[model samples]
Target chain A: MAESRRPLPRPTPETQHFWDGTRERELRLQRCDACSQVYFPPRPFCPACASRKVSVFAASGRGTLYSYVINHRAPPGSGFEPPYSIAVVELDEGPRMMTNIVGVPQTPEALQLDMPVEAVYEDFTDQITLPFFRPLEAS
Target chain B: MRPGSVAIVGAAETTELGRIPDQSQLQLHADAALNTLADAGLTPADVDGVATAGESPTGVAHYLGITPTWVDGTAVGGCSFMLHVRHAAAAINEGFCKTVLITHGESGRSRIGRGGFSRPAASLQGQFEAPFGTMGAPSTFTIPVLRYMKKYGVTEEQLAMVAVVQREWAARNPRASYRDPIDVDDVLSSDMIAYPFRKLMCCLVTDGGGALILTSAERARDFPQRPVYVIGTGESVETPMVSQMEDFTTSRAFRVSGRAAFEEAGIAHGDVDHLMIYDAFAHLPLYGLEDLGFVGRGEAADFVEERNTAEGGKLPLNTNGGGLSYMHSGMYGMYALQESVRQLRGTAPAQVKDARISIAHGVGGMFAASGTIVLSNEAR
Candidate 1:
């Protein structure tokens, strides 16, 4: 409920496309044209090859919970409820991103490693939509 | 090119360790420098080389009223001082300067005259990681630790023992901020700051600083105190942010720096008499032990849990109580170096009997950077 007080990120020119895609509920990833390597956090060139010939593309928005921590203490008045989880999710394209696990109890029992998760967007502002992760339900 | 060509002639911490709300950050640096200068039987004029981190070396040199022929300000993180020692040794060997002085001071607890770091909103960490409500060191450091716990099956109780053992060492040191005995249960029940990490697992926030003086091995014996020969030194950097570490289970910088130092010193693991690993968190020592090849991968936890690194154990670690029980003034590396010097000089409160060789390894910016120094009481 204390969503408004959470720290918000301001996108730079290098990461504008990724942030813009979040507003449309799309997870954007940078793929290297030379090596076909996909990387996260939206870098201009490929981390593997350092090639500037990279393209931003809509990702599958699906990933697995690689690792996480359940924070019991929140900064005073930060609006983050206690027992919330901060996590690193490994995307299907072979890149990882830091996010929060939502739509489930923020506990070790609920947020197991390697659990399937999908991206969910919360529009904190008209220009910014932070991407979070939620457990994927079996079809 | 010899490893023991340079030696540490003087080492001392701030007059007071735990809390000094009145002293500014620079004054703390000056106090430690003056103490070390007195210990070395030298004055500011004798300090021809200077190095520091968190604060500008120029500022330290100017305030101490000394002009240096050589200066290094390598601020990689908390481990900056370790790198400074390595650089100072190289500088001295190259005849850049004869006597090198390295100082570290931070008013972390008091926040008195400490510099602030602000990144542009578009910066890599600012854009990617900081926006996600990641709290400072406590929260960011947990990223890899959680993975390490799951991958290696490290139990919470095992991690708690790190604090318990270090506290046992702390009980002996009079300058230690926390000398009370603590148990695994005490650490487990302490306030959970971040998941998988309790308050006891984190380092104590205190205001203090330490200084070191290094000169040629030829002039080392001329000094008043027992010179701790700097046999080997290595320094390296990995990533600026913990979230970007190459691996979650191990620190690449630790391996690089430790291996280089071991190779330079030509000493085996069994030869080490005392060890000091920068323990900003309990997990760091675990990584340092394994990554430095002291113990096999995945065996460090059991090694520590079995009381190997505790008092009277096969390998006594953190004899000055370490950052966990001693005083951590932001940059904890300087204090680690000071403890190593103390152990080599046969003057540590929790001295290891007949301890000849001490290795001081430090991590800066989580696992982002590392520096390792090998010291010996006698020059071969």
Candidate 2:
């Protein structure tokens, strides 16, 4: 069996705008026009208030390392190398997203919880650009 | 909704467990279902309601040649079986069905006629979490423990203790996989799969299944085996993605589900004689302990380290060795419920003497959903 390439995101009608922003190196999020509450993994309606009145806007792309695990075993066909860090970053706008930590050693000593980090985009394909995080000081 | 209205008269696991290559996923369900029916001294024709996960209740009913009046195919995650039990009980009381058969089977290791665990690119997980190289449970389900450790001053040794103590229970069970005794040192020194989770802290991936039969309390006494009354039940969900959990230190779903069960049962924490908190990973029991109000915040680590949940301790937990030392087919909630039934029936390998009440609590996804069931030997 041959090694399979890593999976890429497929944008839906509701989430296409967020993926579109990523291709241009911008972090896009949805906020409710009625409640002014921000959310992620975009949808047409506000999850908080069930209000369909929402708008898309560019985000700061800044966050802090909330939690993560240094994976020692890579799944078959997943392009990740062993000992890579899979982290969840708490965005400044209050929604949290899962991403990878880059530009630093993927070890407990290097990736501290609550450490300030910023988004860096990787263009995997013409249609998909994944956003990873790294120590703010490293950038 | 009322305590003791419904009771479990039949409970059994597959004829064989741990690496069953001969049985496909549906066959495993059939094997367990047949075993359970035999345990209750009934036949497939007697079952009027069907509930299951992994395999559809429709498929189970058709394969077993039963024409069911009511069925539930709830597949939230590992804990789906717990929800099935709750739903089955309510369905029975409402006259929707008489005898309910809930079954679970998964060829997790053999991959025999089993579906792949992939999400569509357009799905929520595929769009956000999976794109970043998230592997299955080991990578994703094990993500929140780091924040939990930092917030509560939990140490790696304490986490290892969960595996160690459960192994003690497994050692006494003849059917447990990898029943040889293991200690905290052995656990800590074991291979690391994910940070904060060593090889022993992770659940074993084996192929097995279990089944249960429930009916109204009035009809339960006619069965051959001791009837375990369904005293209370609860179920809830939080988020599908681990990153979206309200707080990493706790499981909001577990809290909500457990409280509802306890309230419905009208029992205090002290009334529980045995407990089974789904241990898909080591951190789960820690979160379960606090979230279920068995311990205060930041106290579960010390509570387990102090031997409160170990053998001859205040609360006997995971007495069947749990998913860690016991058998963990992808969905482990069935096995958890089985152990609760065994403990309450006084037939468990590591049975607590004179055990009366047992609570089986399970988390479905990565803290995404939860279901809790309280069982007792006495009707009251």
Best by DockQ: 2
Error of 2 at A44 (Å): 1.3
Q: What is the C-alpha RMSD of each candidate to the true structure, in Å?
A: 1.6, 1.8
Off by over 4 Å in 2: A1-4, A75-77
The C-alpha interface RMSD of every prediction is: 1.4, 0.8
lDDT of each: 0.90, 0.93
Which pairs, if any, clash in model 2? none
| Per-model TM-score versus the true fold | 0.97, 0.98
User: Which lDDT value does model 2 have at B70?
Assistant: 97
Model 2 Cα lDDT, one tens digit per residue, B1-380: 88999999999999999999988999999999999999999999999999999988889999999999999999999999999999998999999999999999899999898989878888989989987777889999999999999998999999999999999999999999979998899999999998978999999999999999999999999999999999989999999999889899999999999999999999999999999999999999999999999999999999999999999999999999999999899899999999999998889999899999999999998899999999999987
What is the lDDT, from 0 to 100, of the residue B119 in candidate 1? Answer: 52
